[model samples]
Every structure is written in structure tokens, then in C-alpha cells.
Target: MGEIMGNFRRAINNTSLSRFRFYFQAASFLLLIYGGYLALNLGDQLPTFACIFSEPRGGSCYLFGLQHQMTTPWTSYLSGRGIGLLVGFLTFIAFFIVFNKAWCGFACPLGTIQDWLTALRARFKIRYANYAEPTFQRLKKIKYILLALLILIPMAIGNSFFGLPKLNHDFGVPFCMICPGRTILPLFSGDFSQLALDLSSKSKMILTALGLMVTGIFLSGSFIKKRFFCLFCPMSAFHYIFANAALLRLSKDAGKCSRCGNCYRACDVGIRAIADDLQHKNIVKDDCMLCGKCVEMCPEEGCLQVKFLGLPIYQSTAEGFFKRMQGRNNAK
Candidate 1:
């Protein structure tokens, strides 16, 4: 078992093309587009598959129509329970535990869009500041606060402790409403207005505020960091909270590390894999999206791997653990 595991680790560290990762990512993007399309055109016809927030005021949609019920200002909103939300959330959790944010790396449409934008910026020789630097690292905490607000505000509104329902009425799934993925869905469907809701004068101010927030994300992506919106996303918050036990992870052979800083430089999240404690090397950070770029960029073979259920998968080598034992003996 140990021999097979070691060989498997070696293979992943050596290879560049990860088909499983790529396919899952492609599928995710396709699904988001399709779902958005349905939301825009077929929303009136299809039974709500899963809408966690509110009933489409316009039609008989059905997947998870509970969202419409929760939209009442006096009630706490629950938008993540609809069939689509359930499936998406479950799939995200399963992938997180199995691949440790691989969804963020490959499957997330939001991440994909951000990567595309980042690529464009890179083409122009522009790049954001590295998150590893002390000055920039503080920014990572912003997401946690955003996450807390998402949960707390809804609870408060539901409890009637505060008149937060007024806020909820203006913004449905306030956290998700501003999501870049949500924003992109409408654009992909050729109807940018689909994401917008009709509002009164008071609600219009709220819309303006939300619009500015989204605009800020776009501007930040263009001039600062790619996917700056991700820093404050509630979905990312949920992923970070639940992906702690992810099966596949970025492992390291610390002894072999030359500490050349290549992996850190290669990492989109700017995690210092080689320098961190071996126990901390699992790509387990809340910000880690598991894109496999670090694994692809590492120069030393057998130094990193995508561990599945704590076992190595995707790539493996013929040299078993016994070979390593023999090599050590011979060296001695």
C-alpha cells in the first residue's frame, strides 16, 4: 500500500495534464450557463428546479420554490435549498472533500471568468500584488467578515430583533445577488437585465449601491487583483468552512524542497507551500482554489501530489516505496 502510494505521488508531481480536473471544470461551466439560460428564458415554463430565495414573481418555476417564501421581509431568507442550489452545494462539498477546492480551481464558473480576465491582464503585463506579502495578506480576512454578515443579517431579520427585513426585501439573497457568477449568468444568456429586479424609489437606491459594489469588483479585477469579488463572497465563505476535510490535497516532500520559491510564485492564492510546515502543506487554506498550477509548476518529482481520500490519485510512478528504501540504503 505504501509503495503504491509513493509511486502515485511521484506521478502526479511529474505530470502536467490532469484530465479529471479539466473535465469537471468544463462541466461546471456548462451547467452554470445552462442554468442561467433556463432562468432567463424558460423560467416561466419550467417547474422551479431549485430556487432557494423566492418564487419568480413572474412565473410558475419549481425546482426549490422555498426561496420565494423566505423573501418576505419578516422571514429569514433561505436560498441555498432549492434543487439546483442543493445539487450545486452538495457537488461543491463533495468536490471540496475529494479534491480540496478543485471546484474553485477548475469547476467554478466565477473562477473561470476571473482566470480569463486575469489572463487578459497578464497579456498586457499587468498583475495584482501577491497575497503572501504581509501588507496584502491582511486583505484575506475581509472574506470571513463578509461571510459572518451573510449569516448574521439573515438570522437577525428572521428573529425580528431588528428590522433587517427591509434590507432583505430590496436585495434577494443579498450575498449571492452580487455574485460575479450570478452577474455573468445574465450576460451569457444575452440578457443582462435578467439579474435586475424592478424596484421602487427606495429599492432603487439599494440597487444603485449593489450596482456600485459589483462595479467595484470589475474595476478591481481590471486594475488590482483578478476576481477581487471572490475575496468577499459568501459562497467562498461556505466552501472554506466545509472544505476542511477535502480528500485530495497538495502534499509536499519537504526534504526535497530547494526553497526556490517557484511553487509560491506559481500559486494563485500565493500560499508558500515549500516554506510552510509539512502539516500545513495540504493546500487547505480557505483561499486555495486547487487549480493544480502549483502541482504542474513544481520542478522536483515526488515532491507534490493530489491525494484522494488520503491516497494518491491522478498520477503514479512505477518505483515503489521499497525502491526508495533501497535507494536510501545504497546511499548510506
Candidate 2:
């Protein structure tokens, strides 16, 4: 028992956890696309940034339909009966609290695709862009705006919520009409049908054109910058609002930190706050997906760590960090 405990302690003491996340991302992405839903039925839950407006109204199904079952319950809840809504939300929360935004890190199909794009850029030695603070802060607002619109447009569709001004019924699932997920995610599943524009209705034609445009921007932006679409993901906004129950989180030991800024440089989202915030112990920023990149890059002992329910899983150490960093630099 002593030997077993010793080994487990040593294992948990090690840093450099990003490789595990990459493997998990690959496995989870495949499992989801191939019909694996955590029995919570949210196996298809939209990423942390999937539109919440999509929640009550339904019809914003992603490729592979992972969250379609999830949508049905919520949609029914909106109409009348509350049982499905209560059960669905509870069931989702039960599993969701375990990992929080980790769904963005290890399971989102579009995020996985962005990882592929980053890898492709790396393979070609292509330079990727990182935004400056001012621009990044400005870009951050876009998602909140998108989130608001995602809600308002769908609510408008229902039109008669206790006698409120109604938007057009033709605008059903408005966000879906322009979601890049609607246009791009389908291509991977051998569904080219989304590419066709329905000239049948003005709404259809306009939305189809918008989808194509957004899809183009998504592809180009992803190729140019890591996790580009994620910066504006309304789903991410939703997660931030209710993520207090999440068990998996990132924390920092300011006393042990060297202020190296390596974590910020390593972060895919370009959040400088991780390096700038010298006071807060909970280093997990709003933009942080708990992807472990910051933890992996941190070079100071116990400076950064990923914790599950407040227990440390792994912690930063100079030896492990330098070994991993050197290997990565050499690979470049």
C-alpha cells in the first residue's frame, strides 16, 4: 500500500499535462462524432459557446446531432410541460459540473477542428497571429452581443410571450442560419447538402449567404490564429454565467510564480491577464478553457496547477517544464 501510494503521489506531482489533453480531445471528439453521448444525453451538448437562444427554441443542431436530444427537452419545456426541462437541465448539470469548460478543451468538434488547423499551421511553419490587449478586449464583446441576439431573435420568433412584440416566425433558429457550425461541421460528416442555398425564400437565401460568409471567415481565421472562432463563441458566454459549480479548475500560487509570462504566451486565447494578475489565486480567467496549456508551460515549481475539486492533479515545476519546453522548441 505504501509503494502504491508513493507511485500515485509521484504521478500526480509531475507537470506537463497538455499531451494528455490532446489525446483526450482526439478521443472525445471521435467518440462524439461516432455516436457517444455520456448517457446524460448532452453527449451532443453544444460547446460552451453554443447559443443558449438555441436552448429553448431548438433547431440549432450541430453536425452529428450530439445535442439534439438535449435540445428536445428544453424545447418542450418552453412550450408547456416542465418535467422534461427540469430533468434535462438537472441531468446536464450533474455531468456538466464535473468539467465545466473542459467540454471546450477536450470535446468540442469545432474546437478539435481548430486544433487541427493549428497543427497544420505548425507543420508548415506558418506564423500565427496573437491579438494585442486592446483589440482582444474589443473582440471579447462580440460574443456577448451575439449571445444577446441569439436570445432576442428566437424569443422574437415565438412572438406572443404573454403579449410581447413578436419578431418574424421565418426567423426560426436565427443563429443557426448564420452559424459556421451549420455550414462547416457538416462537411466532415460527408454532408455537402449545407452548401446549397435555398433561393426558395428571402430569409433562406440571406441566411445561407451569411452562413457561407461566416464559414469562410471561420476557416480563414482558424488557419491564421489558434481557436479563432472560440473568441466569439456565445456558448462560452453562457458557460461563464453558470460555471460556479465546476469542479475542474486552474489555480496559481503567486508566491511561487516567477512572473515569466510563459503561461500567457502559451495560452491559445491570448489572455494576458493570467500573467498580469499578480494577486488572485484562482488563475482561471473567464476566457480560460482549463485546457492545461498555461499549466504545461509554467516553469516555476507549484506556480500553476490543474485541480479537480480543489485537489491538485499536477503542478508546475522547473525541471519538467524545461524538459517539455525544450522538446517543443526542438520540434519547431
Best model per TM-score: 2
lDDT of 2 by residue, 1-332 (tens): 99997577556555346777778877765555443223223433444333222222122223212222222323555665555445555655655678877878877767888888998998899999988889999998898887777766665554455577665555666666777766665565566777788798888888888888898999999998999998888777767766776888788888887778998999999888788788988766657777888877888887887788898877777777778878778966
Model 1 has how many clashing residue pairs? Answer: 19
The parts of candidate 1 lying over 4 Å away from their true place are 1-14, 18-24, 35-96, 127-132, 162-168, 194-201, 219-224, 279-281, 314-332
For every model in order, what is the number of clashing pairs? 19, 7
TM match of model 1 to true structure = 0.68
| lDDT of model 1 at position 70 | 37
lDDT values for all models: 0.53, 0.69
lDDT of 1 by residue, 1-332 (tens): 99997676555444444344556656655554554444643232221111222222222222122233334433222443444445544543554465456656775555666666776777788757545467446777787876666555444434555443334454444554544444444465465663565465675556555755685566566345755656554555566676757666767777666666665776666666444546555555666776665555555555666677766564212243234335548856
Error of 1 at 270 (Å): 1.6
Candidate 1, after superposition: displacement of residue 274 in Å? Answer: 5.3
